[model samples]
Target chain A: MSTPDDTQFEAAFADLAHAAELMVDPVDSAVIHGRVRRRRTTRGALAAGLAALLVAAPAVWWLQESNGDENDPPPAEETTATATPDPTTADESAAEPEGGPDGQASEDVEDPVLPAFGDLVGAELELPEFQPDGGSLNDACPSGPATLADGTPEWEDGQWYMHEGPVWVLKVVHTKLEEGGPTRAVALIGCMPVETMVRQAVVVAGDGAGGWEVTEEVALGDTSDFPLFDIAPAATAGVLLMVTDTETTGMYEPVPVDYRIMRYRTGSDLEDVTGEAYLLGVTDIEASVEVTEGEDGTWRIELTLTNAGDHEAVGFQMTACGSDSFVLEEFDLPPCTADSEGVAVYEGLAAGESVVEEWTFTPPPSQEWSGDEDSGMYLLGDVRPTTYSAEVFVYDPDLSNNGFRVDVTPEDVA
Target chain B: MTPTRGTRHPPAAEQPLLLRPTLEFDDFYAANVRTITGQIFAYTGDRAEAEDLVAEAFCRALARWHKVQDYENPTAWVRRVAWNLATSHLRRRTVAQRFLKRQQEVHEPPPDGDRVDLMRALAGIGERHRKAVILRYMAGLTVAEIAHQEGVPEATVRSWLARGKAALAGRLAVHDEMEER
Candidate 1:
């Protein structure tokens, strides 16, 4: 005996199937084929071009010098040779400024003295205006990958190479900053290869308190193949820029150039405290609550703590608050010796940090109780002397308790 | 193309030279291009992005022709690529849309049928549910096939199908009521 709902569902499913058939056509397939061919040719051309550049660097330099007048003196090849090594090192060093060598500000010394694009003056560098070339690369290309249709390299002769690539320019206007505060509405423009999409662009504002809050997340790009041209708030000073290559070719493998940023602000300048506190690193924090039915049919509560922090948080304590109706069930902490409170504190947590702490508890058996119903409700309190923010909720079912919270308190900072 | 009839079994010890088949660009486009475009169009509700995604999907497929050709359904393979490309596009678009003063026009309801509305509703019901609906109803795939593709248990796929159908019905009913009003 099928219910009316079942019959209706079957009908809708059939209708949907029919509609899909209508949508699919041979013409669509042809378009896909053409796109694939173009992409293959572009990649092959790009690879070949890169190889040419590697081989032709000295030859090109010689050609330019030979064509020049004798008075020019060919601009000392020694300086050029010495200059190249430092910038490569400097760029690599700047890539991880927070954890860079000797804990010194590399940008201060290198930006002013660098041979190419000398001086780190923000005002001197002009923002490229928004323009659509209509499949022409005549204008100065943005710093990122060239969206030009032709395989012409965008970076040419120390200037942005322009080509008919997938590039969209967004106008950022109406900029305002809060009085006496670090500039808000600061505009941040990020450029990457069209292959990499900007995932999340956040401007972290220093909370008057000792924490950082993401004030805004700049919008991603419109075209998947084309990288984002502009991100905001266009006027915020000292913004942390981020771009994510969302190509999921190999799900397990990390995307090359997966995370890159020109972070303007640091914890020292933005943090409320005067003393030095480095941003050791960041890791995804995860906390969950488990509910299990007891022999008596009562639901029990079990709290599990996982150290998802990038650095080992010494003497870390996670306190969770939940309804008193359920008692703490069995608790176990892996990779760390269990304490009296069922807390597991590891010596250190590396990248891809994970800790599974489970608490099993029986809820009060009674008026139609299901463990899954109330499983998601748990309170997470703030982590004291906060090194990281804690996310407390059930991700499996995407449910949150109105009052449940988790607080993390740091102890004995060296 | 007709298959050649022969009693030709290559010797076990002989390393067979894999013939890199020439892909007919026209045939490939005819089979997959629009589905890729449509997937992006549906995901982003943007024509420009849909076109870009279609182009990129084909580009990627072209780059990995040997692997793509080996798949049972190359169209499905390209469609998945387009879907992923569309997702990235939307992620970037969300950022662009946030700062833009004026929003682009929402996709209009199709005049001929409620299919567009159904698709819109499917889009609203989260990616997991949308995938379930798309794979089962749109692709005409069975529950087990969907489970295998999604890497979930058959029971879970069944649950998603049930929940998705209910959610769609509820949304449609509300939409109809709004129209009536």
Candidate 2:
């Protein structure tokens, strides 16, 4: 036989079901086909672009080194070709710190003839307000005919077309969870010209300690694909590092070479308070506790228990351990079952799930407990091996202050 | 017109090639194009983006038409494609839209008095609960069908329905109280 509460609950659910029924319809079938087709095209394009990069990288490097002589010939170039050993020829030169056969430099390489603008071109566009809030990029321009001073550029439209490729920015947001645990961070990266094909790599560091590092690269074909990527759990504390390469091109060389890197991080410390609760499992049983008033005219703890896995718990039993100093204001539980311990449990709690319970207490007359002394600390014990895991709270009857304690003993299960 | 040895006499005049319908290609395009487009548009709430998504879906479908046509519910097949496409689009365009416009608006307030309250409760519910409510009430799907579609145990679906209903009632009560204030 069901109680009045069960009946009321069923009625409420029926009403909700009726409401949901009013909002149904069949979606247009044609539109579905079109969307699928478009997605396929974009993915195909991106794949092709990556494939091209893989194929062309080595070839481009080879071409660059071979062409370097047109600009600067080696000191031994005047020597007879046959007399010079092959090992000491282009191969040895390629291994030099000043860039070898491939024209890629080993750290100390310096260009003898620097361009007028110091190899840096392009002006800094005003960054978007929503750009990543962490990590700053280290800027280097090897072919600067254009120069930027004080974050602005001198020429607007020569080699740099107005808004041609992605303008990149990076920032980190961090979130801390639990004390002494590594904080989770979300790296934010913003790229502009939203239409240019681009790829980016981001690294996150936690409190200068080692943490998980990931790199995500996205090649977008159009502006519609901006806000290209996101990292979750926006960090509360961490350093975010980002490197971005955009494709740029010149008349004789490949247009759309990879360009620019910007990085910055939120300097604030992140504190996160997120946790998980598990139900563990349930059993059919009953339990109880007691409550009494304290000397400070507030309700004092009689007994408390917490449900810690291993068994299912159904109800609780509370007995007055001291003088009746507290009055029961109300009990809370949906689909509630009766219990003697001033504790109740709802049905259908599965294993590995948890819910928070809150109780308010009022202090009795003549008992004034200091509120400052007892905040956030609760007296709760474990009631295990039964249907419910029992955790109890006790407070002053006047809502002034109270202590909480838990009692979980193997012998207490009944 | 001369008749061939093993064939019947052809038409006196030959028809222009352009005028001749390309049955295979046209049928393929018609059956696949619009359905995917519509599904994507519904999911994204943007006409231009929907167009792009649809185009991509069709391109992929065309590449694998032989395999796709063999599926039981081709329309459903296309819808899944569109759904995936729309999700990826949303992922890339996270900050572009101020808010995700829902695929469909709530046409009428729920049968219960507190429409807004019910919606808030619905929002708080998990994806399964919301889906259950949508399927059972709005889509008129049977519990068994919902189980099949969601790949969940029937009991799980029933539980979601029950929980969703109960939550809605509590929310409505709260709403009523607020209105009284």
Top candidate when judged by DockQ against the true structure: 1
The global C-alpha lDDT for each of the candidates, from Candidate 1 onward, is 0.36, 0.32
- lDDT of model 1, residue A383: 20
For B1-181, candidate 2 gives per-residue lDDT tens digits of: 0111233223536534543223333465566555445334333444445555554444444445544544454444444444445543442242212111222332333334644455566555433455466456534457886565444469868877775565555555666677789
Candidate 1 per-residue lDDT, tens place, B62-166, comes to 555655555566676566556644543343343233322133445534313676667667666544456676666555578987665443469968877775676
Candidate achieving the largest lDDT: 1
Per-model TM values vs. the true structure:
0.37, 0.30
Each prediction's RMSD to truth: 23.0, 26.9
Worst 10 residues of 1 chain B by lDDT: B1-10
Each candidate's DockQ score against the native complex?
0.10, 0.05
**What is the C-alpha lDDT profile of model 1 across A1-414, one tens digit per residue?**
222275565566567555443453322433334433332343343433332222222212222211112111222331233223234234433332132222111222211111110001111222232233432221433423222121111110111222233332212211112211222333333332344322223333323221223355433332344333222221122333322233221112322323233323434232121112112222333455555545664444444444454433222324333433334544221111121121222223433454455555443433333343244333332121111111100011111221123321111000
Interface RMSD, one decimal, each candidate: 17.2, 21.6
Relative to the true structure, candidate 1 reaches a TM of 0.37
TM-score of structure candidate 2: 0.30
Chain A TM-score per model, please list them: 0.23, 0.20
Q: Can you tell me which runs of candidate 2 are displaced by over 4 Å?
A: A1-358, A361-414, B1-70, B74-114
